[model samples]
Target chain A: MGEENVMSDDILVIAEHDGSNVVDVTFEMLSAARELAKDSGGKVLAAMAGGAALAGSLGAFDRVYLIDDPAVSNYSPEAFEKAFTHVVRDVDPGLVLTSTSTMGLDLAGGLSVAWPAPLVSYVVGLGREGDDVVATSQIYGGKLLAEVVVDSPHAICALIAGSFSGQPSPEAGSPDVETVSLEGIGPSRTSALAVHEPDSGGVDITAADILVSVGRGIGSKENLEIIEELAEALGAPLAASRPVTDQGWLSKPHQVGKSGKKVKPRAYLAFGISGAPEHLEGMRDSELIIACNTDPDAPIFDVAHYGTTVDLFDLVPELTECIQA
Target chain B: MVLLKQLPDLVEELEPSPDGTDIDREFIKFILNEFDDQALEEALVTKESSGAEVIVVALDEPEVDQVLYTALAKGADRAVKLTGVPAGTWVPTHLRAAILAPFVRELAPDLVLTGVQSAEDLDGQLASLLGGYLDLPHAAVVVGLEVKDSIARVVQELGSGRSVEEQITLPAVLGIQAASQAPRYAPISKIRQAMQAGGLEELEAPAPVDSADIAIAQVRIRRLYAPEKSTHAEMLTGDPGEVATRIAEILRSKGLVKA
Candidate 1:
């Protein structure tokens, strides 16, 4: 079932920050929002929950709604949702865009239900199909893509990182900034405690010229030693996919994914790692990539410069011996 | 304290139906979602640490009874199946929340936990929607959870290895990203024993009466297809040593491998 297509196509970008600076994803959204604005004819508006200082970076947008609330300044989920809902309810834009990041994931799903809008998430592609908003979402760990049609006048699209090229110009005065207070946010039952940065256990994988990454294909935690030997022979740091770290076989610092760390090493040797979009987002930009997996259809081959359907156990030991020789 | 979902196993090949809305699930192997397994583990761990009763729930499916039995094997106190939703059909996140709301209201537990996401829908959304529907506070991507008195302390994963700790009052919902430890395996004997005991409770509930819940996006999927191969890797056809030597040569040619 679809709704009547009205002309309230103004796009709202829920801008996020690294505490103080506007995030790069916000700019990419602006770039897409610019294209969408042409078709929309309505203005592009960015709602910054607490990003007043970073408003200067959003020159490409038409206007900025600065939710000037202190609770939102620090992200306690309850307060931030209340602050965002307050602005969205008042503005009532047609399309709401946010990144599918840690905070964005919560807001996208929460606000969609709270605002009562339909939401399309894990979106890699976004475009307007006449009156309908078309979104392509990566599902089943990037095994497949779903083409979704948002037949409603108002919708929310949570974009995956790197889906668009967004370079925000650091200029001001393009858009009017409206300062507003929290109108209806209730007392937050949730409160922040402290933040911990993932310790790399003294290894900075991002700085490595060559990264030897392993995925779930490595089999067991005891088998990690084989991959480690290869990394040692190659003079590289050992990195892994989320599953490996989630299993506690390695530290979070050794993780390569959208959530872990983005690395552009001189060479990335992936063993047994199927390239989920999340993992691909982190290491796909390496100078040269070589993938080893048992599955020929593994998506890692799509990004690898050279790939082989070799059993990682067989290939890894041989590769280590060759490197040592 | 725990909710679960069974999803199409990733190991199985997934093919889109001719109509293009969903995958051909008739031949697909169904398994508990990986994150949901972690949710169950977290709930069990919390029960051990904080002295609470752990109840596991899922929508009724042909294979759901086995999953519930497994949960029981892993130390869940009770198992419940909300039945009567058509099998082999898609249930949107909102409807799942709608269906579970009345049951949740009935239990009124201290905390509700579910996987941060499932392959089908809602990456870190199910718990959020459940919280909204039940008018409770919510958090997502929670990697660590600790309950004390009437508060839940959660270690939430932010991007780039950054994590923040947050405390929530009891009777809240959480989208659990992982348990403190990996899910423990249940023995085959225990699973068999739990299944024979047959204490799994069932309640029949159809789709909500106000199904029109007027969502803007109106969650109907249109098509499913594979991503185009914008680039394909050059397959290195050789012995393991030969492929390694070639990889070494390529790295050196790229000026990455130092002599």
Candidate 2:
């Protein structure tokens, strides 16, 4: 069999889920893949490695390669890799899309080396330029953008979370499902023991209409009280960038960023946050954004509808009073 | 137990070179990648808890020798540098992985650890690529790791603050996201002691991967540039009170606050 020459104009979306439900990034990958498909004249295929029930969530995909193996019920890296690789080899897709998240990173690189395909990660934008795959990746935590043109026909792209329309995939028609034969995928060397879910009943920032967020510029845990008052006055949830959560100034639930929750509140008030690309990826889609930081060049300004150079310390209490008044 | 890499520190201002293909490194200072530092700490923690040899390896780079020496002072058992690449030049991750594979195969290590990612390679490719080259199981964004009797129990972060725990067989690669504790410091005095001993080992570097092998296109950065600001924000001015008043007005106009 001429396996090496079997590459086709099909982009495979590796769908990820949390135990039972398919995560939003799966749809995002499908969305991005659909865009790529139009240019490459390819079919948007999907592969899921969990319970068959999860396949119901992948209706947007035309064909789903389901590896409904119990070993992949959770996120067992080896089993998932083996099953996904089977699809990649079987389909010989021109492109393979995976989210640049925990599960995606675990599989994408291994898949790349095993398949011998060119790999691109941190992908924010992807398009086909004739035979080449052009990817815009956020490097240096979003400080600079790199235009990587992969000359090869087969490429693996790990799209960063929030790179496209996340949930509510446009197409909802039932797709043809093919059960890939997992003949050789034996027990994996990696065993999934447990998943400690994030604490619930915390201020659900994702559901907040208005979000008052803070970041490293808040300086200390004590300074958080000032922002806390602003959030309370506006009756909005208090959110923070990763550093605030990392420093234990706020619990994990209050954090908003790539590694944190993706929030689209009606209003996003960012104070002291310099707007690392990670943080922006989470809150940039807010209906309205207002940012305040001491630095004029902070990337937060690039996305904010309204911005200021006023120190957060000098601005928050006054803002709180004005809101209350 | 871990690989430590030193690269241009992000704290320094990054400017694209005149050619626009890469960042200008001539004026930038270098520091150990933060994630790699965490990996080193995790290894040192593993060493203290279960008793394991921690060997820190890196490709030769400027100030990398000092970075390794500092690791030795902190607690690593040995330091290694693969020689032959141009000093401080940006090495493609594919080539870097390929170059390290031959040597990593030599070690026949039970466990290989590295930071989940460096700023330069956010894809977290090194661990997985090495796993592919060496044919070992791998995990990424691992926040906690505990090894006992050929089994490595790890807690991997899955964004949105959720995490899953897994038990990986030994002879595996792990991309550490953070350490259970902050990386320990190697007081300058101890660092001097490590340097006096001159323990950094130099291994024969393998020839770079064939250009033909790289034809699979290992992602050449065709260009790098500062992100152009597309939409400048309407910058509010005047006193803090004035700015706050404006913010309040906008919030109300957006129907974000109760009238």
Candidate 3:
């Protein structure tokens, strides 16, 4: 029954981009799509609006459907939905994948209705099980893994950030780029009035190779100096969980979590940080994770390579001194 | 109006059932979803300013009355409890949307507010799916909102803390991430007063249309298990000085710091 319902051996990934460059999660989705397509005997195809020139660099894609209309220069859900729906109808892909970013969620939500396909968001893993695609995701805030069978032949799913490592294409082969035009689409109900960019002086933690991240356990704003010194001693950037940033001790850019910067640094030193799923979603991919918290049962320990249960007040200063010495 | 859900509190320890399909709920404690609380607060705030009647709607569940009374204490004018679906049934978002769309239509609400995503969301989408089902303009992850002159101006949180301001005409859905202000605390006296007022209205949920498409598209939870810990923390136990020295050594060994 599943084989008879198969539409085509094509995995469509909706690529996301800022006006200038392709967002990193788009490649991550492509990587996941590539992995899933291997078992399904499907070709990985990427659908992107704007940033068409970058398509050539994405050699993993079998084909790139670029919608380069000025209307879509900025993300309007209606334009994106119309363009994506057109591509979905034209390609008739077996599976569609996108990042779980805000724009990705908007598009996938719209397409779920437009394509009338079943959507599974926050997908952490995808696999083929006896002709049915199984999507694994976290529910109840990452407490349990829910393995859902995509009953629809053409299933839509969104991949969470940092869930898959986005490796570049092994070999550079220029993918066939098809420029699609979306014209005469009506205006959407909502219109973007303005974008408020974070201050330019803010730290870009995503680009940092090493991060010393603090959480609510740091106690107060005055204690941040010790963590800052430790970060300086280690020659790494200082990052924080949502609580620290929310408390105004650190800037928003310094936050490491789902709603913040998703960093895959070489080393992550977490102090007083309990591993909420949101925080883990950002920095879990680090090569080495060292966490310190007063609570031994803090979930951060689950992903940490090394852990020390102690007050940050006692440990951080001593740790900074040791690192400096 | 605000849509609320009673969720198993996250702080509670959970274990998968013997069948490995879902968490064993017998020992769990249910609490109102935090985001939904914020949505309810947003509605109450709007009511404070615009005199709009705030109605709180929730699926029938254990401790749902507590949530509704809490909303009532927080200034919702009406509370609704939808019946027919048994507690703990994992109704997919689309089915929930199908069930609520008609009810919301009946209310003819100028604005509908829901949490952007629930902590227990299997699909991580309810507001968007509901918007699609209702064919209403919707925005997600909104941090701030103001309803004025039939136009809703919303501040939406984008990736990396960037935000965009957008205007959507009223009779739209908004998936609220945070309210403009912190949710007001309802005192014990107020909550008790609300419970005594006895204004909770129960409504029979419309039976979901039996569609083959929806049946086939429904998500099935095959297994539920604790995520296997790929890497275990090697606990370093000692005085602060000893632990710090050990951490320094480990950092040096990993080439994160110079020896």
Q: Tell me the TM-score of each prediction against the true structure.
A: 0.96, 0.89, 0.87
Residue-wise lDDT of candidate 3 within B48-120, one digit each (tens)?
8888999999989878998999899988999999998756756666677778888898898999998887765
Model 3 CA deviation exceeding 4 Å by range? A2-4, A200-212, A216-238, A243-251, A263-272, A285-288, A293-298, A309-325, B209-217, B238-259
- Itemize residue pairs with steric clashes in candidate 1: A118-B216, A118-B217
Scoring only the A-chain of each prediction against the true A-chain gives TM-scores of 0.95, 0.88, 0.82
Worst 10-residue lDDT window for candidate 2 chain A reads A1-10
> Best-fitting candidate, measured by TM-score?
1
Candidate 1 at B146: error in angstroms? 0.7
iRMS of candidate 2, one decimal? 3.0
Pairs of colliding residues, candidate 3 = none
A1-325 per-residue lDDT for model 1 (tens digits):
3455653779899888877678888988888877887855878898987767777777778888988777776677788778887888889998888888878867776787677778888888888877778888888877889888877767888888888988868655656889879855668898888767677779898999999999998877999999888788878889999889888888888999878999999889999898988899999999889999888888999999899987888788887776666
Q: Residue-wise lDDT of candidate 1 within B1-259, one digit each (tens)?
A: 7989888888678899889888888888889988899999999999999889999989986588999999999999999999987588666777787788778888888999999888777322688778877779888888999999998998889888888888899899888887888789999999999999999999886455253276623656788998888999999988877887887778767776554
CAPRI-style grade of the A/B interface in model 1: medium
**What does the lDDT read for residue B137 in candidate 2?**
93
Where does model 3 sit among the CAPRI classes?
medium
Candidate 3 RMSD computed on C-alpha atoms after optimal superposition onto the true structure = 3.7
Error of 2 at B43 (Å): 2.0
lDDT of 2 at B115: 82
